[model samples]
Target: MRLASTIRGVTYSFRSIKEVLAKANSHKSGDVLAGVAARDAVERVAARAVLADVTLEELRNNPVLPYETDEITRLVEDDLHEPSYAAIKHLTVGQFREWLLETSTTGELMRSISRGLTPEMAAATCKLMSNMDLMTVGAKAQVVVRANNTLGLPGRMSSRIQPNHPTDDVQGILISAREGLSYGCGDAVIGVNPATDTAESTRDILMALDEVTRKNRIPTQNCVLSHVTVQMAALDLGAPMGLMFQSLSGTQTGNEAFGISVSLMDEAWAKMKEMTPTKGPNVMYFETGQGSELSSDAHHGADQVTLEARCYGFARRYDPFLVNTVVGFIGPEYLEDGAQITRAALEDHFMGKLLGIPMGCDACFTYHARMGQDELECLKVLLGSAGVAFLMSLPVGDDIMLNYQSTSFHDIPSVRGLLGKRPTPEFDAWLSEMGIWDGGKPGPRFGDQTVIR
Candidate 1:
């Protein structure tokens, strides 16, 4: 018999394994809401205390600990008042939506809310909003915040040249970097995932990348994406901390599996501060994806997207230089097709930005997921509209090591050109000097030179 069900007088069938996975993955949105409810329940009494103006000061003072109800209640009733609560006291959801839309800067809005409401409280109230209202808030937040603040990203359109090497082949890495830079990408950074995961391998790759970058006078930082411990060892071996790298997850357990801990991150940050960069801070690069919690068995029944946001919260603790959500990389088990992939990518970008994280989207998918380049392209343009900080640069839209299709080096100039954007200022100058960028338009070489010469 067919595995089928009837709903609202319509019957649906899971025709293939992919369809089954799609149906299973479609429950993630509901799971997210359920997870939120479960999490909010634990803080329900605290949330109410804040709403009742019962314990605002105590909560603010002891931000490090879990809330104690009786003490907080007594403190709240002791005549302490929060101005942020007062600001939103008489406003309805519709009114708040209008206010948020009209607000010129997120910093001001965030500051006002910080006086009283915790992010959980704000998110709880947001749950009452309709999807359209939530979408409006996300869109408005990005516009106002981006227009008014740089967040943590560089102040121009940037691209990351991800010359990921499976075998850490020096020639392959150099060729890939050369190709991406020739097409006016790599303004933000040129990073690689070494074929082997070890301190020596990572150091060797970083050294090789450094040699090529200096030899060609390319204006970009370099990274070797191995385990954090390996990279830390590389730093101990005298690799510059200009481009520290890590992949973070929402839960503590998830991080432990990757041999990452908050203390380790702190050590890396401290190490970064010890190094000097020619431009910008020695920023760290972080990659996170939805379904990671589930894949790692750390999901805790929450929506994957919600868990993904928690990952951002964790990453933000470090003030990361770059936070990229590889939106569709998890495959059909979590996000089945192009439509789900596109929606998830937008949601991640919107949520990340709303949470005040400088976000980027690796709009990519795997062949096993039954998705294609066209869908990724759609997500890329949508993210560009949302003012994503940067995107991955593969050679000709294909990553041989990762075995995935993403926006290629050529796609960068085309997307930026269409949106009236340019690479980060320093990289733009380098591109101009190299004759790949002419004024605001791309030079002829940009279109003609797809392969490394």
Candidate 2:
């Protein structure tokens, strides 16, 4: 059905829900690259105006992809909380936006109603929100998940120590992990992105992280960010898997491009539950971002924000321990600059939390992106204040392996102290006991990589 709105005496009409969503999104280079972005600011505002009047039921009825043709659509519809949906399904998107911003809307209420929200509704809600609006309302939803450690607690923040190695060398990776631990950054998980994606390489990396964390008695988990199939192969070889990791896409077609199926992920999650060494209901770690679907030619005329939201919807099914958007890693073609990156980071966090996903951010930019290091630093403070679940912590804000910039180990202390947040309960105690952190301050061995060993 066509949707139309008048602005400044001009009526702009959108042919479909997809067009409305794509045009209404904050200016993302990827949308423009995809030739789906609005031609001008007036059309963009008109699209938002039309979208605000779109009822939740209308969004539900029109999945970005046809329900019969897409499993993701089916999965979203099949799993919705019926009573919660019935309560506010009649409200137009504008009313829902107002409802969220109201002071009476508590975090508990947000949590309770989250199950009723579809990814599309979550997407539409975010499009109409300003940067501060995203942060202000996003802080209301609390999503707690656990593996060897817990995350997403109120007054708490965590950091995933991404000790990536270009050569997949276990020793090089361990040194980085040890360094991160000394800085109190691995309380979330010690995750490694392997340059070599293979069973043996994954198994070796997994064993190394497992041995180090276990021997040191660190109260955290570990994961080798390899393909799910490779990790599964390593698990079959009896590698100690703390948390299984995977990259997810918003559409079935996009997931296929990643060489994954819902069934494969289901099998992987079941296998991890049956065999993972971690003690928890949450054992999966997932990474998602805007523009992944478009990158794979699977966006299906939808905007990056909506496609990104669908990833959270799919991820919630597996009960992931950690989930984040590597917001700018898709590069300048998608995010364009610091402003675009900032907009995407907030939008992703807001949509993820509203849809009941434990959300975090990489807060990064590639060298080619027009963003400077300054904006990245401000982004960390912004997300931390917004009650994000976690942020990626690298050695000096640079991922040597991935060739991008992100939050650093040094940034962890200031973020926590400035934002008045703490690490997960178990990891905080371990940090204190290990002489790495003391009473909300860095301890004597704060930057000593040798402290853990």
Candidate 3:
């Protein structure tokens, strides 16, 4: 479809070219036609560039860029926030999940995100962070590929591909390549999730990323390195829970995961101490997800009025790489019809901000096979700004494409500009200073872990 659109554009450009040439025979008409031709020619080139997969930065940064931002700027407006738009467009699942977690404590976040209501529209222009975060690599990947592609790259894979096979490494390789590409593209601060169970695993993931850079020839500048929650569960180590700590410590994976989750988190300084070796401006992400049942119980310790302050407090103190949280509804319509009404009531009537709301792309509903037409994918995009996190969802691409898009490429962040060089040691020092290592809290630390009876 994208190709078809480009081809159609090229055909139109040619038609304009002919008209311009014919008009060139006359002096006055020729000048206007010539200008039109010049514009058309540039548009033709840009259309082709899109076919080749251009980045937002490329399109925006080009001095001679043909298409003006205004051409598509209309798509950037509030109507894009409409539920109808999101129901039919691209939806970013993971980023949406992240946003919910980030804003869970910010009472300012929106709620009743089911459908018919656009989170972005509900918020004002002061709410720019949502779009900013959406511009990140993760968000771009989601919007560009949709949910269909397996590898998170341009093309799709066959069912015959095996996991251990080279074909199966698509997601990891794409992640590594995108990280390197992002660095080359001026994204210096990289967010990484190392789901390693051991020291060797962490080393392996990092080594793999380094290999991607080396192989792809990406320049290495000082960048921040933040460690996500290490694999700390009994399942992670193939051990049972409540076992003596020493009994499981002998295993490499067991020790590494344990170290990060328990000791590193227990002591902010110790956490920072271990991160020092990475030479980074490090941030730790402690993510937690309560099952559908226990999730309701989350945030009980914090009052509605203090949610924002508390969440921000944790974010400021820990300065995490990213916070991963989750909020799921009983049905997809939870966001659209009635949900929107409830949200309006909370905001308009109560003047309340519901944290951990989902931002959704319009297409999420139709593409999600699990739900019928009445339900839309209840996803939200959250941005960290104004000392309060904002949750907003806009319709971009569709469900058929969500998976595919996610695996196809890195999502672009909302912030535009080249990545600034930050010493990795800085990140490390920050983590250490936060007492994330020795005194860091361990998991099941993040999200709601309590199971329902």
Candidate 4:
């Protein structure tokens, strides 16, 4: 493929698709550290110029990993609805971006075309978009998923009550869930990242979340974020699961690093279906982030965004109920600071939606990053304005177990109020019934965890 461009009389040439994608990406510390990033701003713009002219057909035909070698690539290619791909495969990346942003391109139309688009095509189109472009295009797509409740409905923003404790305390977890519920959060699900991944610890936590969910008649789901194997073991011990959880990667090598494979996950899917008490069709939740594959030495020379899109392709195999990037949690080395995190979060949400999946973000930052809570709040606002499906909520935006700052229980209603959004229909009804939400805003009993009574 032609991988060179001339801008301002300077010609920039790239040797491969990997280089093209890496250089074309907006600045990110991960790509730079990988030594794949553009050497300078001028070259970066030049790469975008070259990438913009590449056709979707070229991208589909030339995955970063050959389809025959990479199961993730095979899954991405094999699942394409041929008719849908044919409709847009002829368009250049620049043309595709324009089509997506066209006033006539409704959400329904995007969904129809989405089935044909490959992750490479999505990432390629993303490279040509600005921050606002990503938001506007992302807002034009709709993807809804349901387990115990629904998510991704328009005019709705949901939260996963991350009641994580340092000691795996069930009561502490329940207390956090109750506080989140008081502020009209937890419509998406109440999920926990256990400090320990033992089958017993996971089982107890899952059963506790399930108990509180039922006892309070909360219209939500519950899950413990553990390794698929650990969760599988817990399911074997009869842990009542709401949504089985796992972290995903784009390449098989990366999956291996995570101690999972396609077959292993397929087995887990079947097990969750057979054992978990949660309702079906969408029975899994997945978390993915940029730099994971590189960190695992499995990036195959690709940029983070391309690999990340492949994650959505991989996730598409199971039709997960929820998928989000733990943005900025990887620290400043990969994302650098608030600007890079903001860019990655928007790109991830946009790509996931374009590929037809429910997408959310953990819009968080590590303490060592050159950013802080103010930057995190800025990201939360941007995601809310971009029509994100959900965001993670902690006691006060501090995940003690995970050691990162995320959205707080109060941030949920604050964003909802600012954007004139509400929780899921089921949870909104429950919130109103409990006197904690009214007229699209917090009511008399808003921050009272005692409302669980």
Per-residue lDDT of candidate 1, residues 1-453 (tens digit): 233544456544433321222223233433443343223232333222222331223223322212352222222223223566665545533344445556574634643443244322233234333444444455444311121113223224578888887788887888788888878887667888777988887877778878866776766788888888788788788775447789887666667767777778888777766662424443677898877867777654444654565566566555566788887777777777787777677666655655555677788988887677676777777767666777888888788898888889888887887777777665677677767888798776663444334
The full ranking of all candidates by TM-score, starting with the best, is: 2, 4, 1, 3
Of 1 and 3, the candidate ahead on TM-score is: 1
Candidate 2 structure lDDT? 0.92
lDDT by residue for model 4 (114-144), tens: 8898999999999999999999989879898
What is every candidate's alpha-carbon RMSD to the true fold?
9.5, 1.0, 24.0, 1.1
Cα error of candidate 1 at position 34, Å: 10
What TM-score number comes out for model 3? 0.31
**Number of clashing residue pairs, candidate 2:** 0
Better candidate number, 2 or 3, judged by TM-score? 2
lDDT of 4: 0.90
TM-score of 4: 0.98
Q: Which candidate's lDDT is highest?
A: 2
> Per-residue lDDT tens digits of candidate 2, residues 38-151?
999999999999999999999999889998988899888999999999988999999999999999998888888888999999999998999999999878888988888889
Q: Report the C-alpha lDDT of model 3 over 262-364, residue by residue, as the tens digit.
A: 3344354343434332332322323221111112322222111122112212222232322222112222222223333222212211111221221111112
Q: What pairs collide in candidate 2?
A: none
In order, candidate lDDTs are 0.61, 0.92, 0.24, 0.90
**Which of 2 and 3 is ahead in lDDT?**
2
Model 4 spans > 4 angstroms off: none
Measured against the true structure, the TM-scores of the candidates, in listed sequence, are 0.74, 0.99, 0.31, 0.98
